[model samples]
Target: MNNFQQTARVGLFFILGLALTWVTFETLRGGKVFKDQGYNLIAGFTTLKELKDGDEVRMAGVKIGEVERTRLAGRRAEAVLRIDHRVRIKSDAAATIVMAGLIGTNYISIDLGTDAAPDLPDGAEIKTQATADLNSVMSQIGDLGKKLETAIGDLSGALSGGKDGKTGIIAKVDLLITENRENIGKATANLQEITAKVNKGEGTLGRLINDPKLHDELVTTLDEIKKGAGEAKNFIANAQKIVDQVKAGQGAIGALVFDQKAGEDVKASIANLRAVSDKIARGEGTLGKLLSDESLFRDAQSIMKKADRALDGLDDTGPITAVGVVYQGLF
Candidate 1:
């Protein structure tokens, strides 16, 4: 009875050990014991971002598949995804490896592609994109920190003007004061004297400030200026009104300036004047003939000479002889 009991105890211990080993294996392999009920698709990327087998594949924060396997094919690395058969992944869907958190595990992430696109077939390659790595980000941050430190050091050196012969604000100000001390003293003394004279009412500016009569005169002058300004404003308003009237073609000047019909009439009158002048130049009218002919002057001169001769004959002869001579001359 004792020997039989010992053999049974050993068998029970062996079975317990086997169960523990199986549990550990399942835990390490992501706990998927049964066959995955899904079709496979391949995804290729420059890097998998620490993605491994048995990682969950999610679409829109929901788990729809798992990464079945990963492999290095030629130059690029690839991950085979086992997607749920019921979940339709579009042909244009993209896949990427993303971290769950800063220190959490990485997983394959699928995007919900457009509904109009066809479903991705089994064994088809899904598109992939490379993500920013944490290590690279940390390295960039360190480099930025170093650069910022350098800039701050440079700014400090400029402000403090380190003892290495570099000029700074403080050094320049001290030098300026040292060089102009005598001029500054003279300016201060002159300012004091001018202020004393002003207090004593010894100049025109002082009288302007302290004398009541001058103040009243200044006020009167200012009032006159204000009155003039009002008149100027009225003049400007009248000028603006005239301009508006001109723009509206309301007066003769406005009509000549803004009225199209008036301008056309003026142009027509100018053309008529030109035509008349041309006619006159060609001796085609009465005025043109009067200006161009010389026969009228000759006829007037002959009449004048006959009248003189007739007058002389009247003075020398008797009444009947004078009448006969005048008749002959007239004829």
Candidate 2:
């Protein structure tokens, strides 16, 4: 019976040892004893940000794989991701080291690439993009705080004074106010007096504001001026229309100014008038001879004298004798 008890105790101890050994193995191997049936993808980053083996690899927040291992390859750190055979990652899928939370572990997060993109092959390098981690953000915030502190210090110094015994803006402004106090008071008094006069209808501005008759006259004058301006605008528009018509060959002036055929005709008429004037001046035509010949004028005067003699003879003779007398006189 003692031998039986010893054997039972040994068996129990052996079982416990096996259990302990199994738990330790599972912990070290990330709760998986058998190798994962998946392809490997290399993801490179400048810094992994505490990412390690067995960290989850997720595509759009869904777990698709695990980071099989991490290592340094030359200048950059890399993680070998074991993606499930059932899941396919596109060639354009980018990997980023994302923090689960402020206190939680880091993981590899991927984006869903375009559907038309080809699938990534085994052992291919997955593209990695840098992200602003909490540490970097905190560092930038600290820098901003320092800059703000510096700016505040400068503003305070400028407003109060420098340490070099020079007067500050506030002090200088106060001194200026003290020196100009009397002048400022005089200006303010003048302004108040003017405003009082204006309110009481004592000046032009006062009348313009307080006297209804004057206001009506001013409005009438403004209306007249507006009417005159409208008339001027209409005049200008009509003038512009006339000018446009001239440019477009649409009226008599337009034809004379813009029509090539009409202008050519005008030039030809002027040339013909010049030629006729030249001929007249040179006594080449019958009208020019009548105007220029002295002989023609003398002949006309002689004929007038002979006709006068014949008329004088007819007054002194009988009808038959008068005819003979007029013929002899005219001849």
Candidate 3:
């Protein structure tokens, strides 16, 4: 009976150990033992960035799967993700390794692609994007700090002078001031003298500033200029009105320029005048004959001499006989 009790006790202890081991394995596997392990998808990355097996795979901050394993393929690394079968990952969905916090473990972050996109097939590779991990960022920051330190040292050297006995900016400036001290003093003295003269109204500028009469005259001149400008504006307005009237065909000049009938009449008159002038030049009309024929001039001269003789005869005769004598002489 004692041997049987000891054997039973050993058996109970072995069973207890197996139970504990099973429970620990189930917990680590997320209690998915004897259940559907889901489909696998490959995610390729330049680096896993501390990702390991059992790390959560999240979509929009919600865990939908976990990393099954990580392996290197040629020059790059890839993670095998075991995704829940119910959660369909679209073909266009991208995966990225993201950190939860500065000290938190990294996870696989996925984006919800468009609803119209087809689901990615099992065992197919999921798209991955490179992200700046904490280590890389820290390393970049360190490099930047070193570069900044070097730059600052260079600036310090430039400002404070180099080790080769070169003069710095401050030293050069001091030397310049020392060399030009007398000139600077003269310039300052001249400025003071000019200011004193201006205060005493000794020059044109001084008078313009300190003389009330000059100020009043300047104001009066300004007022005159304003009045002149106003008159000029009114003149321009009147000129513009005249121009508008002309443009509207309201004046003589406008009629001459824009009235077709008036233009035609003027053209006709000019044509008629030209015709008459041509006739005169050709000696074709009475005026033309009078102007161009020597015979008519000679006849007029003869008639004037007969009239003179008849008038002399009339002076010796009675009034009734004077008419007869004038007529007989002209006949």
Give the winner by lDDT.
3
After the best TM-score superposition of candidate 3, give how far the Cα of residue 40 lies from its true spot, in angstroms: 1.5
Superposed on all Cα atoms, model 2 deviates from the true structure by an RMSD in Å of 7.4
Off by over 4 Å in 1: 1-17, 161-163, 177-253, 264-331
Candidate 1, residues 1-331: lDDT per residue as tens digits?
6998999999999999998888888767754566566899999998887889889999999999888889999888999998988898998889888899788589988999999999998999988878888888999999999999999988877776878634876677777888999999999999999888878887998888888899999999999999999999999999999999999999998999999999999999999999989988887787776666667567667878997899899888968798888887788
| Residue 319 of model 1, lDDT score | 81
Candidate 2 lDDT for residue 111: 96
lDDT of each: 0.87, 0.90, 0.91
Give me the displacement of residue 308 in model 1, in angstroms: 45
Indicate which candidate wins on TM-score.
2
- Of 1 and 3, the candidate ahead on TM-score is 3
How big is the positional error of residue 138 in model 1, measured in Å on the Cα after superposition? 2.0
TM-score of each prediction: 0.59, 0.70, 0.59
Full candidate order by TM-score, most accurate first = 2, 3, 1
Provide the lowest-lDDT 10-residue window in model 1. Answer: 27-36
lDDT of 1: 0.87
